[model samples]
Structures are given as C-alpha cells and as structure tokens.
Target: MTSEKKTYNFLIAGVPYKLKTSHDDATVEELVEFVNSRMNQALGVTKNGSYQNAAVLTAMNLAEELILLKRKAHRELEKLEEKALQLSMDLENSKSNKVLNN
Candidate 1:
C-alpha cells in the first residue's frame, strides 16, 4: 500500500468505469482484467447471460476464494504457533533435566 491515491479509467465486460484507488496502474489493470474474466465466465455458463447475474456470480466466486485463503492461512499460523510452544517446552525440560543430573 502506498500513500498516493489516484483515479484510473478502465473497461470491464466492455463497460467503461472509473475507480479511485491507492494502487498503481499495473495493479488497476490486473484487477480490471481479472474481473472481466470472471464476469465473462459467469455469463458463459448462464442461459440468459444477464450482466447482473454475472456480476453476482463473480462476486460470490471472489468471496469464496478470499474466505478459503483466509481459513488456510489461519490454520497454518496456528500450526506454527503450536510447534513454537512445543519447542519452548522441550528446551525448558532439557534445562531442568541437566540441572537435576548435576
């Protein structure tokens, strides 16, 4: 994230739109391309191919991806934390065992 916020104009599904974002030109371009791709996919699968329906489907797909990634990252973090705690306990036990032997 950068401190500079700018406005960008791009087309999605052949529709022109303007967006204000803190991201750079490349990021804006990538986002527009990705959205268009998703919307096109949704439209392709539908019989009527309504833009509104396509938009809803695209939004749902993106939300599902976000939630799945978040859950995976959280589970990974928990595993790392658990491993760290186990290592710390083992070190403490080793230190106590050495003291007892002495």
Candidate 2:
C-alpha cells in the first residue's frame, strides 16, 4: 500500500496542534478537515476555563464513541455474514434438489 504523509491542524482547548498521519492522498484531506472542525467545536465548548482538562475530557468522550461505533459495526457485519452463509446454503440445496428431480 502507498502511504503519504499529511499534516492536519486543529485546536484543542484553545491551543492549536498539527498532526501528521500517513494515509492515502484522496481521503486524508477530508479526514483532516473533519478533525479540525470537531476540535474547534470541543475547544469552543470549554472556552471559559480549564481548557486543557476540557480537551482531555473531549478526547475521552470521542474515544468512547468510536469504541461503541466499532462494536455496532462488528455486530452488523456478523449479521450480514450469517445471512450470506444461509443464502449460499439454500442455493446449494436448491441445486441438489433440482438434480435429484431430473
């Protein structure tokens, strides 16, 4: 796989940080833009005081959300796989029955 380094700038707790990650050129820019927007919103929420702590809390919340999303995605994938397997078995059984009838 081809890896390209991309730089993303975002605000965390009113402080700006640049993050560099290796990703495909096409999608990395979009990911960077999204990260910047989310960081800005989180920073805005904690503008009054203790920006650093607020940023940390925001990161924790985002991480938890990601974990839950992953779990949900895995469950959906499992269900789809089971459905596919059942379909394949049914197809095979149908073919065998047709052959027996002939």
Candidate 3:
C-alpha cells in the first residue's frame, strides 16, 4: 500500500494525457477507459467535434452523475439508519414489556 502517485499515460479522443494518481494499474486503466468513452460520446455529439468543448461537457456530465449518485446513496443510508433505529426501539420496548409481565 504505497501512497506515492504513479504516472499513467493514456489517450482520449486522439489526444494523449499523463495522469498521476495513487490507483493501481487496473483501476487506472478502468478510469481511463471511462473518460475516453465519455469523451468519444461527447465528441460524436458535438457539432464541430471540438476536443476542448467535448472534454468540458464530459466532465460536467460525469460530475452531475457523481453528485446524483452521492445524493441517492445518502438517502438510502438515511433510510437504513432510520429503520435500524426503529428496530432497536421496538426491541427495547419488547424487552421491557417482557420484564414487566414476568
């Protein structure tokens, strides 16, 4: 588990880029593929196929997805926590009722 960043060279939309990160080779490759796929989609849909514009749009799209996923995860976690709390309260009440009956 080395914390040092490693360099990864990849091409996106025919442009070369070097990324430095702490991710393993396979993880980095997956990330590169994801970005390249998004860039290609953006480039294909753009009127002029402007690389810069496509990249920016792709970034915005990825960011939007990330935010939405985070929000959905948060909501799900909250619901799970609420259910756990309710279950704990029910369990405590049942125990108290048993003790009183005994």
Candidate 4:
C-alpha cells in the first residue's frame, strides 16, 4: 500500500528545507539527522571548510558508502543464490537416490 506524500520541514547544518516525500516522519527525521551528521563530519576534517565544500564532501562520502554497500549486498545475494542452487541440486539427487534404492 502506498501512503500519501507528506510535507516535512527539516534543518541540516542550520539550513532549513521543506520536502515532500512518501516516507514517514521518523524516517524523514532520521535522514535529516544523518545528513547533518555527515556534513559536520566533513567540515571537521577539512581545512578551511566552507558549507559548499562540506556539502560536496558529504555527497562524495555518501556516494562512496552507497557504492560499497551495494557491492556488498550484491556479493551476498550471489552467495545466497549459489547456496540455494546447491541445496536444490542436493535435494534432487537425494530424491533420485531414494527412487533407485526402492
């Protein structure tokens, strides 16, 4: 079931934004907090960090993280698929052996 879009007002790095999203309030709040935290983390590490620099750094960091996570998930899915196929083959072999014995 799809929920109606909601208008949420949130602040990140002291800047306010109004967004229309299908996500629930808690999710929106959590996302806002995470972005703020990332921005702060970038600012803290960079020398002479402006908001623009921090924003770009945060975006890059998030992109790298997303790519890494996607790669990990894909590898995990491949392993799961391989295991499922092996299990299916084992079951088929077991059935064949049972019929041969009978």
Best by TM-score: 3
Whole-model lDDT, candidate 1? 0.92
Q: Give the better candidate number (1 or 2) by TM-score.
A: 1
Q: Estimate the TM-score for candidate 3.
A: 0.93
- The backbone clash count of each candidate, in order, is 0, 0, 0, 0
Candidate 2 versus truth, CA RMSD in Å, comes to 3.3
TM-score of each: 0.92, 0.67, 0.93, 0.92
- What are the lDDT scores of the predictions, listed in order? 0.92, 0.74, 0.92, 0.92
Count of clashing pairs, candidate 4: 0
Scanning candidate 2 in windows of ten residues, the lowest lDDT window is 8-17
Give a tens-digit lDDT track for model 2, residues 11-70: 543466777877665566676566556666766677564666556766777899999999
Error of 2 at 83 (Å): 0.4
Candidate 1 versus truth, CA RMSD in Å, comes to: 1.1
- Model 4 lDDT on a 0 to 1 scale: 0.92
**Clash pairs of candidate 3?**
none
Cα lDDT of model 1 by residue, 61-90, tens digit: 999999999999999999999999999999
Model 4 pairs in collision? none
As for candidate 2, its clashing pairs are none
Candidate 3 residue 62 C-alpha distance from true site, Å: 0.6
Return model 3's CA RMSD, one decimal.
1.2
Residue 92, model 1: lDDT of: 100
Q: State which candidate, 1 or 3, has the greater lDDT.
A: 3
